[model samples]
Target: MKDTKILKIHNKSDKPDNIVIRDNNLIEECIIIEKSLPNFMKDYFVYLKGSVSVSTRHAYLKDIKFFCNYLVESQELTIAKEICDITLEEFNLIKARDVNLFLGDYCTRYYKHTSQDTTLIYENNNRALARKKSSLSTLFKFMFRNEQLDSNITDGFNPIKLPKPQPDAIKRLDIDEVAKMLDSVENGYGLTDKEKVYWRKTKLRDKAILALFVTYGLRLNELRELNISSFNFSRGEFKIYRKRGKEVLMPINHTCEVVVKDYIYNERTKSELLAEEHKDALFLSLQNKRITPKAIRQLVKKYTSISMETSRDSGYSPHKLRATAATSLIQNGFSIYDVQNLLDHDNVTTTQLYAAHKKHVKRDIVNNFEWIDDKKETSLD
Candidate 1:
């Protein structure tokens, strides 16, 4: 009898999607860190798991761990050797004044001795300090409410005032720069011989990635988690998962449609070289695996740096690309509320930042609506 080859099907739907799995991993990591802390931390852990996102929970755990380590290192408690050994009674001994010292002084600058001859110095800006303060405040409040601590000393903790972010402070590509970036990806404008080799293979994919970013203003993770099934070309629509577990449908513009279809039909559809595990992924690397966030960041930097004629290290991040989309849409007379919907901004105030950018508004007034120029005001004579 002739042998029949049984081709195995890659059923990605049988398993949880990437976002859920990534979040679950963070939750598991939080659990591990929580177990290493004092038993009373369980209450806070459970609360955070239910109320907050996994990333925030993990970050809070890290902040708490550092604070606990600081207590032991500073000789403030003198009794515990490690965070796990710090008892509830000893924990209760910490006062708001001590927290004030940690946040105000130690947090501003710190040192870690990696080896006998080597050390690393760290600095935290006001924003980072504020978040650390918030993490501590949440933990302190939880402990006080549970009667696990001696008393509420949160009121005494010093405030960390962060400066308001101005519209001028936001960095994004101008309209012409956006076109140049795409052109560079398409035509290899300034790529070196070494980069050109890889560029030839990845240009279509890179173009599609950049197009989706400038058009939809998708976040780093949102773009990273896209799958082939996420796009419905027949309807000119695609799905993106946003923060707080939001799934949004985005309309595919002409540029995105053309570039994406070119990449999919011309390149990505050649599945013979693809890994079974990454079969459903919308983007792939030279290794035939799903693309990583680091790779996307590097590619964006390479293209944007060339487009802006800047150093590679000074290239903008994915978030800045998001800012580019917002400002571009607003500059083209799109409504702030509508841009807010596309960008999935939590509030219109966030979208208002892009709208607040001073593009040609000041220039237009100075050149055309000028009162000081007497040559244009002949009626005044």
Candidate 2:
């Protein structure tokens, strides 16, 4: 782990004690990739490490690897055998047409991965292709900015146009379904005898997790990163770290507050199951450690499948709970701007997409229209 001392203090509360500045695992992963790639690419990763999030850097590395594979297969470039051998002159030979071909071909072909003599073939969708193209564009821009390349070949190529948003694309549960899901969690309606026995032990924690998701529209990572100190009982609020490292405080409702408090004080404190390292974490797995995002997702799927009939069609996940929370707020007469703030969206356009999904607004508008009197009115023929 790397440590940098704080030279300037803007606010005392802003800098928490023992705060992790960078993920050590991510730094180690970047170092491994740096040793494998060419010097220029290594430098590019170093530049990106300072500016972007760990997740973004990880994705860029994967995309660049895909680009290298494309160069080997399509262009018959020997440098692909060892990425470190690729010269600047070879990089400059890549044109906009080559990039176009890469994007087009990626969508149609299968990317094969082999490990332990087992092969897996993955197909790229339009969105995946667009993301790969964006990653390549960022790499080219970096090369041009640093004078490593004479010009950016990716600049002339047109980007892939995404399809317009559809109403059905946003899958969310109705208010009644949300109520049923909560009830099922509390009552253990459809669970097996063995599952019910397990639920009896962790019901409070499970309820708290579900309440937080439906009430605040928390993303999986946001929920997972929560600590016991994050909640302010006096203020009736809790703090969360959002994407891009932005921290925001959100008010807790009566129901969420009750469940979370019950889990923390009644169940969590009494249990001696927690690992010492995860003592400060708000939610814990059966293994007595901080819960993973995958576990939280599976929890949501398990409960929703038992509680809602439309779970098969709508698909229940943590994100779907977020959408349900947004839709419920809109249905309850909150403004789109309010929903945007609650959900922590960077743009109002994303909130507007939820507004488009509100079928009641369209129904009310159509219901208010007066029909012409067929007996009294005549055509102006």
Candidate 3:
């Protein structure tokens, strides 16, 4: 007879916010990927877990996993037969030039066979290549710091030059467009009768969602992770978990207060309306589940597309709505530094990009400050 102890399942509502739970799930994913990697790479995983944001750590681990797979799969370049079998000695043999070719040639374009008759081609731009490089760099640097590497091979790795973001390339809705989007959310303007049916039931909820996005300029995940307790109406503020595990308090304005109150009191279904686990979630789907990022994106697109007078498919994401908020605030004479703090940007230069948005600036300046008399100039011509 074989005897084994029963594993106890302890899943329950213990965490204060869903963001912490989501972050822990991401960390678990990193650990799962790390388990598939070689033993020597475990230190790097621990280092990342301690030092980096959950998303960044996940990306780094994924990149490392891809690289390890590449090392084993590329028969001509590596002696190792599998990723798990890749030893520290085998990894130490990897030269800077080998990595350069892998990033520059292999990562730029690749094909993955899905089935006997199907294949998927993947391409990485300079930004993606740079990220992969940064991942490798961090790994090597960490190992080198601990004397696990023969030398800091990252020094020899060729630098990937990335294109600088230009102000003219920024996409955001102007002030009038912002007003139009809000109006559409409130009144269900331009929605097909079919969409309007759903919109009518969720109008207050939708309005609250859009209002918070535009007012707070929240990242998709940050807003998605909101809990009912995160808001303190009497205090006129809400708490949000930011990147790298920062908890920031954001002041709630009158408009946001009204819309959120309207949704919670009038439209938001609670208790049996939820899937038991998502009882504390701020936004909800028709299926009584916490709203997913994709759903939020689609709603943003629906209203923004109406505002832009574009096709439904041409609608913007929550991020574009974030850009709209930044530009609108800046255009209305708010300090860029203040906007930077509000947006939780690490650099003021990022806020400067929003400040540099020149929507109608050229024409407005010319129209308001015409130095030459148009009639005289026309007669001379």
> After superposition on all CA atoms, how large is the RMSD of candidate 1?
5.7
Stretches off by above 4 angstroms in model 1 are 1-16, 358-366, 369-381
Clashing pairs in 1: none
Q: Give the per-residue lDDT of model 1 (tens digit) for 122-215.
A: 9999999988999999999999999898799999988788887799889999989999999999999989999999999999999999998998
* Model 3 agreement with the true structure over 284-335: per-residue lDDT tens digits: 8888788998999999989999999999899888998788889889878889
* 10 residues in a row with least lDDT, candidate 3: 5-14
Better candidate by lDDT, 2 or 3: 3
User: What TM-score against the true fold does each predicted structure earn?
Assistant: 0.90, 0.86, 0.91
**Which lDDT tens digits does candidate 2 get at residues 65-121?**
767766766655445566666777888778888788778876447756577787777
RMSD of 2: 4.8
Per model, state how many residue pairs clash: 0, 0, 0
Where model 2 places Cα greater than 4 Å from the true spot, the runs are: 1-22, 73-75, 111-118, 269-273, 310-315, 365-381
Report the lDDT of model 1 for residue 132. Answer: 93
| Candidate lDDT values, in order | 0.86, 0.78, 0.86
Off by over 4 Å in 3: 1-15, 358-363, 370-381
The predicted structure with the larger lDDT, 1 or 2, is 1
